[model samples]
Target: MASLNILMAQINTLVGDFEGNTDKVVACVQRAVQSHPSPVVVFPELTLSGYPPEDLLLRPSIELRVAQSLARLCAELPAEAWAIVGYPRTRDDGLYNVAGVIHGGEIVAEYSKQSLPNYQVFDEKRYFKPGSLPCVIDIEGVQVGLSVCEDIWEPGPTLATARAGAQLLINLNSSPYHRGKRGERWQLVAARATEAGIPIVYVNQVGGQDELVFDGGSFAVTAGGDIAAAAPNFEEGDFWLQYDSDHAQAPFSGLQVYPPLEEIEAVWRALVLGVRDYVNKNRFQGVVLGLSGGVDSALTLAVAVDALGPERVEAVMMPFRYTSQMSVEDAAEQSDILGVSHKVISIEPIYEAFMASLEEEFAGTEVDTTEENLQARCRGVLLMSISNKKGYLVLTTGNKSEMAVGYSTLYGDMAGGFDVLKDVPKTLVFDLCRYRNTLGPCIPQRVIDRPPSAELAPDQKDEDSLPPYEVLDQILEMYIERDMSAEAIIATGMDRQQVQKVLRLVDINEYKRRQAPIGVRITKRGFGRDRRYPITSGWRIGD
Candidate 1:
């Protein structure tokens, strides 16, 4: 039986660092050659300049940098083994997302990505022209087909490659992380392999970009739709697979096949990776957040500590007149448990000063939400001051439920460089807190047991201003995520007035969401790139 060894390099890459990205590719190729004789190393799509370069592809110097990087790889990569590297190729018409096969210090064969994903955080059509032909290359007497990320998602490219007489398919990808995405990828690859009557090697990039985290769950599947080998997700490594040509069907074998993470754990890991990469890639000193001892802030602090470590995370409890002693104690307890540097800065003095200044102007008017918001603003000011002085990124703790209904204070609680739970709803906030505690008791039980509050007003509870989170989250899922109208939501057995009010809050809060910071997107429809709405729209529900 003739056997072949293939190496999948699942790596994390920084965007626009041409030299750095190329160096990583070359190093991985060298390692592959050293470990497996005559092995073919497959890298993720656009390995040269990183994936989703966005407008960086439009830069005048980007082409030159890509050319230089490719030249370096051709000259320095091992001569005995074949290397499949993804990059951008310029043509007379436009640029193409291409995967080139390099052997013996020269370009042998190349495949351009055909399917350009334009929706849901992808804008590939803006940059690359689609390729029409299939690319099949000979590797050690084995016919191997080449396809980029989106090509394998649809049937055209893989089917074309099969018709061209390829025995195996290699799909390079930079697919980002979302809940249950692994199962989807696995099923897609298995089905494609079966349709093409060939085995497949799916290699994906692993790492966190600005708001996206690619969990490298690279693997191989048989023509029979069976997983032959798999690698760990949210990790970087060179996974090897052995394919026996003699056994034509179900040939690939070897390597550990790690199970997919459960939903809560998967979401938790995504948040941690997203926070870690954003801080490290942007080169922040560390992170700081105002821990209000509520579930949202508690979870944010825990995520920060997990991502940046206790020494790097700073927690501050800004107490106002309405702040409960239990809130203060719970905040202190969690900080001590996490071993993060904790401080208590009373906002009373600042609030008093602001009220005194506004006394003359407020003489004829009654105090309202303005005063409540001022308390929050005072906390924001203190947190931002610490951020500016100490070089830490302020992590806002507002969850999606609050952000959806305009429950958050602008320039107050919403003032930060990043919001850890921006896409997470209040119900999930409690779930995540419990999940984190399962790993370890980092959050205080009292914090989770207590009813959620802003603590900005006397005995203020979140339910006092909005619907119950359990009900509100359901309404939000239907309206915001599922794109159901208010009428449709009311049809789901919810109160008509409640549904109307929640929908109105979401509609009116578009301006606030527009100004919110980018965070990790765990859902199919996130506020930033996924779900886009016009802030000035006069569109109304049930019109």
Candidate 2:
């Protein structure tokens, strides 16, 4: 049996950054050639322009630039080495998410994606034409089967490739990270490799792209359904594997390693990377947010400081007349500890102006929730004003639990360039605050212990407007994520009236979510793309 050395460079690449992505691929190939005896190196799917170009793939100019970039990458390839990369291939049928195998400055083999995932943060079918055949290439007396990301998730694609006389399967993946995805990926792909009796290598992309964070838990499994070698998740590195015919497959030793089982820390890291990359890739100077001395803004600021450094992150304390002195002190202390630039811009005068403007219609109301909402909008206007003046992107600090229950004010706190915790729930928000403190008390301890409040009105607590987060998050998980009916939610030993009330708020808040900016996702069901509900939905009834 012959031996083959394969190098998988799980490098971080940005979306739509053609020059950067191309340069990355070229550098990786050079490193691969110098470091290992492998003649072939594999990259994550869409390595030339990053994964899920979204609607950017639709632009003809982008496609042309991608093609030119690929040509440039080919021009720099060494004579003895082969590069297998993923890119977009255009044809009469439309565009295809393709994998190109380039050897000697020419594309030797190209395979289009067979299964385009359209569910759960994916819209590939809308943009890509499916490929019907398998692509195989021979290198160093070894037959390599080629398939894209989703193709490996399904069984038939892998089997079809193996049956077409391929000895080894190499899958290029840009699989996004969700909770417990690595275990699931290993289970399915290992099962597929066992069934087909072929060794499988999975390479995933690393780094953050908008709401999506691709954890490069790339790995290789043997034909007997055992993990062989794996890469580290949430980081970038070059992973190598040596395969020999006579050696028995050791029981899958180096399968991917996750964070120290600290799930909230993982969430925090993902958020930091997401914010850092999104801002850095989009060419923003820095980040600005309305710091109301709440856990949500506090956590967002911590994440921003860790992600882009405190030098690039700015926090503005937008205090209203009702904003408490404790809120101010806690926020200021947090800013001081995090060592980021801080500013105090009171929104009381602006809030008074809005109330005066609406004095005619709100005369009989005697200053209600409308007044609270006005304070938020005033803060929003001020944050945006600063954003426009300094060219810094405003980061909204609303969490998923608030957004889910419509407890947030639209065109107000929901207004920002990017939302850091839009997909994180209230429970997770508390957990993250606790986690941040464990890392040497970055967040003020009082900020984590104090009851959550919007502080838009005097003596206002989150419970005043909504149910307890413990009960509320449970009810929400059942109804929103699990698709439980209101009756079903009540069956879980929850109060019927509370269930009905929470359901109503979630139903009415669809319009607010529709108007919200895109936020970092950390849950199974998030507001942005994963969870879709109609604004006109009337699917609930009073319990």
Candidate 3:
């Protein structure tokens, strides 16, 4: 019947900003101590120096700084308050993604992460060695369990802690956001609580880190499988959850509730936050992109303007001879509708310049895709020039379907500091454009209804080189994202030759995706961290 007050700080942290993260952690603990009676404040995993530090963890100096910051935080903790903080831990062998329990000005208990995720964007296996021990800490007369991010995804870690006589399970997480992930986490946490016969507290990191966007939907589930308390998603806030064993009969916590966003809305918010944080945190003045009269660029521009504001977005329309007048007019109309600065840059001169330079080499050959690619590359050069001259970052606008099939040029539209839709499928790109227009007509309707084209060659359409997006995206979702074998994809009632051809395109385009700019991930498996394929492999999928 005893009650323990636990405060969860759903914080947004900048990656590699050790000092800022430490300062925020200190402030949260201080607030928790002052607002409640000897509260235990918990933060997300690796929150001391931010999550997924990438190669920054490889730098020894960064590790030293992280350790010193932890020490400084421990020194600043109040005598009555308990703080469970996450950071990097170093041993004789290497480093670890570790959590430290600080009480009375020292680390009372430390737990290193047992599960090191090596797949996707996570390279923890390459950086830190796993710890084998389960850490159990006493929090205000209650036996509390401790596990890092990936440990709770599997059952053994939670089951182990329950067997070790822990009454309450506390997991610190830095789980990233993808479509429908909140529901999935709720299901996973509820299952864990039911199996262990104990209450569970799950805290996830918030905000964007590079291409990864962390949606902070931290919550608590009771032993009987009910959401005892839940934090707001996608923002920073501190809330206290009072857990009373007797009050398990009545699940009334009337905390501030925010309904979950729809799948499309969630994906849109994640993309906006990812672009906002990546551009702002990296210290770019603004963003510039080629506003091709296509859904990919149109959606990219809408998301960028939404994230960074219209004034911060600059769209350049680089038209080629093959580009239709309707395409040109719609590009300008969309820019005007969005209230962003627009420029008309003709790539004809640059294309002519490149052709003249290569005239001798092309003396006997008829003009082909090589000439078309030159036009795309010409636009890329001009976009980069604007980016370099104005201190703005160039945002590439290619989508997942094109990127997967190598439908894009290497240095053409592919040139940029970051790509906004590199992982978004072509179907989702259209969906997003429709979603944006529903908010208000930010994009021209003509742009949406028109056939998609690269416009590098005369009257070219995407269907000329690739399958229809409806068909192509379905095959891609099966083969690329879901990891379904080509035969399994073919069983989905698709053309056998078409399925094989799309798979081949995906395999061959690995080299192009390798050099692609980091883009926001909307699917369960994105090209960013989750999808890592060999660039030069001889593997074939289907018959």
From the highest lDDT down, the ranking of the candidates is 1, 3, 2
Worst 10 residues of 3 by lDDT: 248-257
Which pairs, if any, clash in model 1? none
**Highest TM-score model number:** 1
The model with the greatest lDDT is 1
Please report, as a residue range, the 10-residue window in candidate 1 with the lowest summed lDDT: 534-543
Task: State the lDDT of candidate 1 residue by residue for 427-480, as single tens digits.
Answer: 999999999999988998989999998987788899998999999999999998
TM-score of predicted structure 1: 0.98
For candidate 3, what is the TM-score? Answer: 0.95
* CA error at residue 220 for candidate 1, angstroms: 0.9
- Report the C-alpha lDDT of model 2 over 1-543, residue by residue, as the tens digit: 666677777989988888888898888888888976655788999988788788988887976887798789778987667788999888886898999988888888999999999997999988889999998888777788999999987889999999998778899999887766777889999999988888888999988888888878788888888877888777788877766545546423323443333566668778887888889988899999988888999999988988899899899998777788988998899999988888999887787777788788777766567777788888889999989999899999988888888888888998898999888888988898888888876888888889998887678788987889999999888887788889988887999999999988888878888898887776667777887777775565433
Candidate 1 displacement at residue 395 in angstroms: 0.6
Alpha-carbon RMSD of each model: 1.2, 2.1, 2.0
Q: What total of clashing residue pairs does each candidate reach?
A: 0, 1, 3
Q: lDDT for each of the candidates? A: 0.91, 0.84, 0.85
Question: Which runs of model 2 end up more than 4 angstroms from their true locations?
Answer: 251-261, 537-543
